[model samples]
Target: MSLVRSAGLQKFRQSVEALGGDPEVYARRAGLPVDALDSDELLVEDSALAAVLEIAAADLGCPDLGLRVGRAQDFGMLGPLAVAIQHSPSVADALACTSRYMFVHARDLSVALVEDPDGSHGVVGLRYSFSAGKRPLPQATDMTMLFLHRAVEFLVGGRYGLRSVDLPHQPAAPRSRYEDAFGARVRFGRDAALLRVPSSLLSRPLDGVDETLRRLALAFLSQQSSEARPLVTAKVRTVLDQSLGTGSTELVDVARALAVHPRTLQRQLAAEGESFASVLDSVRRARARTYLTTTDMPLSQVSDLIGFAEQGVLSRCAQRWWGRTPSALRQEARSRARPRA
Candidate 1:
């Protein structure tokens, strides 16, 4: 069972009720015991909870219901801080303030406003670095992006959408749902999940402002750090790094590198919601893209650098991983690098 502790629980319940579902029934479907739903403990873990949310959304005829719930929850938890941002002089300041306060309850996530050097625009991106035994699932990342997109839209009262949405896993279902939810080009199987929004949106005015609320929110966030890293993730990353550039990468190699038996490493990684295959694939895919785009090196040479035995094998894997051919990827990279008219 996975644990869940959302600061927006009350708001989530209200949203569910508004959407025409009994909160108790929703909680029960989510696998939470009856008392667990009403208790003030603020933490519960039952796979059924996520399932319940999905089912509730489907029943309510809101394909974006999950997104709506997430936004309400985020707003309930961060509204005061958001109001303070609304009073700020510029979008940049608002984003910086929001980013600071948003982490109060969820320090596992990071948000940044990255400005383009040419002064064209900026991007607001989110990064999640999970603690040991707590890597987020792909659905969780998608839900978070959906919430952020909706919250920004609510703040601006405009049809705001991401410039790009990046994910670490390939799409498991039809692509239309992703397209409908994000309204942006989605890139999957990448190192980290990211949702890129225009920098200008950061400067837009918010609907409320309250200094006291901001202060309170900041205080609350300061007290929460359950998302901090554990030594395990660092070790896993290290093992992955060393195993790359060699065709001998395997579970055994990872176990030996971490000074544990293979089974122990497997169990530990499983606890963290990852497997050796997933980590290795991430490392190779990231390195492959870096080599392909950053250098004029031939595809075969790039394959060698990333530990592929043959260019053909690398090409096949890259296509499956990125949904694009090598030549097409290179062309797209060049186009992105070109100067705008």
Candidate 2:
């Protein structure tokens, strides 16, 4: 499964309890261990993290749950990654560092600077996306978007040239909620989640950057990444997770992404006692469970998102995998998520 550091849930418990919902109850419903958020070093499934946020939002009657939690978090939650970023000489350097080492935080999440998304000059889009089977739930997107906004503010103080925020999905909460959280014009129903900023801001040097500290922090992160480098099976799982929704789940496409010959990739999986098809099924199963338990999405939509051509295919697979129909699985999940009096 695609995993992320528990730091993503920095204020999760407080946000849930503030809204009068039990964090533990919601965590359990989303297949996360109750203590998942207790340590930043701990790893949890990325989908589970997303699910817990969405579940808490729905159960606690808080439509702006992601924004609330995100507003309470700062760069410190990123731990060593924060230190390295803070010590970068320029905003562009920091963003490059973030893009490179973010995998140390969340394997499935990606962020980058894109030039002129709307074909405008001197503007850059800081885009956030998940390499998972499909786009994340709205609450997850909201949380990340707000966090990115806050991080830039921390780096440059109040002078950060944030123009607007773009969101992929339509408003899940009020437009004012997004505007208040971002402190900028917020546009919804966009192609990607982005933070628009003047490109010149990228070259502005940060105040009090310490080159020595930055190097040390980078060394620590480099060593950590080396130690945590996943096996071939794990790598294949990540590729499959992203490919499932795109109809390119074939082995050759995955091999191309990995820069390996198909035969070479097949042999490596064989050495790990796995096959490409098996890995794809595993990713689909995990995504299926997540979608069923955490979302009210229709069965047909869920099927399409998981790369099945028809709802009946999903139903049959669900029965084979879990001895229940997809509808039955969803009903059970809903029943279990209801709060006790």
Q: TM-scores, in order shown? A: 0.47, 0.67
Model 1 TM-score on a 0 to 1 scale:
0.47
| lDDT scores in order | 0.60, 0.84
lDDT of the structure predicted as candidate 2 = 0.84
Model 1: per-residue Cα lDDT over 82-117, one tens digit each: 555555555566667667655443444555554332
Candidate 1 runs further than 4 Å off:
1-4, 7-41, 45-74, 77-89, 113-124, 132-134, 205-208, 212-341
The candidate that achieves the highest TM-score relative to the unseen native structure: 2
- Candidate 2 deviant stretches above 4 angstroms: 230-341
- 10 residues in a row with least lDDT, candidate 1: 34-43
What is the Cα-based TM-score of model 2?
Answer: 0.67
Instruction: Provide backbone clash counts, one per model.
Output: 6, 0
What is the Cα root-mean-square deviation between model 2 and the actual structure? Answer: 11.8
